[model samples]
Target: MAGRGEKTVRAVRRPEVRLPQLAAYDGGELEAEGDYDGLEFADADWAGQSARGARFMDCAVRRCALDETVLGRARFIDSVLSGVRGVGTDLSQASLRDVEVSDARLGGTQLHGAVLERVVVRGGKIDFPNLRQAKLRDVAFEGCVLVEADFAGAVLERVTFDDCTLTRVDFSEARMTDVDLRGAAALDIARGIDRLSGAVISPAQLLDLAPVFAAQIGVRVE
Candidate 1:
C-alpha cells in the first residue's frame, strides 16, 4: 500500500491582492515590462508577445491569446485565466499565487524553475508542458490532460492530479511528497515509474502499474 507520505503540500494562503481599477484600457498594446494592476484584460490578444518581469495583480485575462508568448519572471497574484490559449508559451521563473487557470490550452508551455502556490488548473489541455526544476506547493490539476509533460527534478508537495490524463508523463528525479495520483486516468503508461517513491496512489493503481514497475526493476514476469 502506498502509505501516508511524509510531507504533504502545505496549505497555501490566498493572494493578498486588492487592486482598485485606476484606469481603463485604451485598447492599446501593452508594454512587455510593465506592471499591470487591477486591470481587466478580457479577450485581449497577446499572441507571440514578450512580457518579462511583468506583475499582474487582481487581473482577469479571459479568452486571451497568449500563443508563443514569453513571460519570464512574471508574477501572477489573484489572477484568473479563463479560456486562455497559450500554446507553446514560455513561463519560466514565474510565480503564481491563487491563480485559477480554467479551460485553457497551454500545450507545450515551458515553466522551468517556476513557483506555484495555491494554483488550480482545471479543465485544461496542458500536454507536453515543461516543468523541469519547478517548485509546486498546494497545486492541483483537475480534469486536465497532461500527456508527455516533463517534471524532471521538480519539487512537488501536496500536489494532486484529479481526474486527469497522465499518459507518458515523465517525473524523473522529482521529489514528490503527498502527490495524489489515484484519480489519474492512466498511470501505467507514464515513464519513470521507479522514481515515484513518495507519491500516494490507490491500491488498484498499483496493480495496474505492476508491469511497469517490474520492468523498471529488471524482473521478467513470465
Candidate 2:
C-alpha cells in the first residue's frame, strides 16, 4: 500500500511524434516500431478507431483525447497517458502493465474483461466507467473521483483506493479480496458498498458505514 502522496515522476516535456493513422486497420497488430524513447502526443484526437491488438510501448500521450475508440485486446506497457480524456471508449480485454493514467477524464468508458497490473490512476475523474469482470491486481487509485462507476463482477485482489471519491459507485457481486478503502470518501453514495463482504475502511468512514451495518445486523449505532 502506497501513501496518499506517493507519485512517480517522469519527464514532462519530450519530443513530439504523431501517431500513425489507421484509417482501415482492424484486427491487425499495430506494434510500436523502434524505441519510442522521447516521443509525445499533444492535443491529438484518436476517435472512432478499431484498435484491436495494438501495442503502445514506452510511449507518452499527453493532453490527447481518445473518445469513442475501440481499444479491445490492446496492450499498453510502460506508457504514460496524462491529461487524456476518453468517453464511451471500449478497453475490454486490454492489458495495461506499469501504466500511469493520471489527471484524465474517462467518463463512460468500458474496461470490462481487462487485466490491470501495477496500474496507477491518480487525480482523475473516471465517472460512469465500467470495470465488470476485470482482473485487477496491485492496482492503486489515489485522489480519484469515481462517480457512478461500475465494478460489478470484477476480481479485485490487493486493490487500494486512497483518498478517492467513490460516490454512487457500484461494487455489487464483485470479488474484492483485501480491498482497502481506508482514506476514501463515499458517504453520500448509494449501493457502493452493498456487496463488500471483506473490505476495510478507516475509523472516520466507519461512522458513515454504521447505518448500513445497523440495517444489516438489526442494531442501532447510537
Candidate 3:
C-alpha cells in the first residue's frame, strides 16, 4: 500500500526446534557452568538451585519446577521447554537460539539483558517478567498472556505478537524494527506509549489506543 515508495516490513522468522533423541538428566543438582547436551529434564524440582553459565543444547525441559532458580548467563540452543512452571526464576543475561517455550506458567521471572533469536513462546502466562535491556530478534509470541511485562531499553527486531494478551506492559525507551502487533487480541500499555516508532498495529488497535496517544502528546480530546 505504498503510493510513493514506502517501505515494506518483513515478518518474523519462527523457530524450528528439532530436538534429537535425548538422554534423561538424572543428575542430583545443576552445577554452574555445566554443559548439558541432548538431554531431557522432566518434572525436575530445582528450586533455589544455582546453574549459572550452564549450556543446554538439543534438550527438552518438560514440566519442571524452577522456583527461585538462578540460571544467569545460561545458553539454550535448539531446545524445547514445555509445561514449565515457576516463580522468581532468574535467567538474567541468558541466551536462547532456536528455542520454543510453550505452556509455561511463570511469575516474576527475570530475563534482563538476555539474547533471543528465532525463539517462539506459545500458550503461556507470564506475570511481572523483567526483560529490561534484552535483545530479541525473530521472536514470536503466540497465544500467550503477559502481565506487567517490562521491556525497558530493549532492542526488538522482527518480533510478532499473535493472538496474545498484554496487560500493563511497559516499553520505556525500547527500540523496535519490523515489530508487528496487528494480531494481538488485547493490548494494554502501562508506560512508554511514545516508543512505538517501528511497530505495526491494526487500525482498530490504533483507535483503541487513541486516548493514550492523545495523552502522550498532551492533546485535549474534549
Clashes of 3: 0
The residue-by-residue lDDT of candidate 1 on 81-180, one tens digit each, is 7898978888999999888888988778889999999898889788788999999988888898887988998998878888898878888888987678
Q: Can you give the TM-score per candidate against the true fold?
A: 0.89, 0.77, 0.96
Candidate 3 on 1-222: residue-level lDDT in tens?
A: 112344655878888888887899986899999999999999999899999999999999999999999999999999999999999999999999999999999999999999999999999899999999999999999999999999999999999899999999999999988888888999999898888888877789989999999999999999
The candidate with the higher lDDT, 2 or 3, is: 3
CA lDDT of every candidate = 0.81, 0.72, 0.93
> Model 2: number of clashes?
0
Candidate 1: where are CA atoms >4 Å away?
A: 4-24
**Model 3 alpha-carbon miss at residue 204, Å:** 0.4
Which residue pairs collide in model 3, if any? none
Candidate 3 residue runs with Cα over 4 Å from true position = 1-8
Report the lDDT tens digits of candidate 2 across residue range 67-173.
88788888877777899998888888898887888899888888999998878888979888889889988788889999887788888877777778888777778
Quote model 2's TM-score: 0.77
Clashing pairs in 2: none
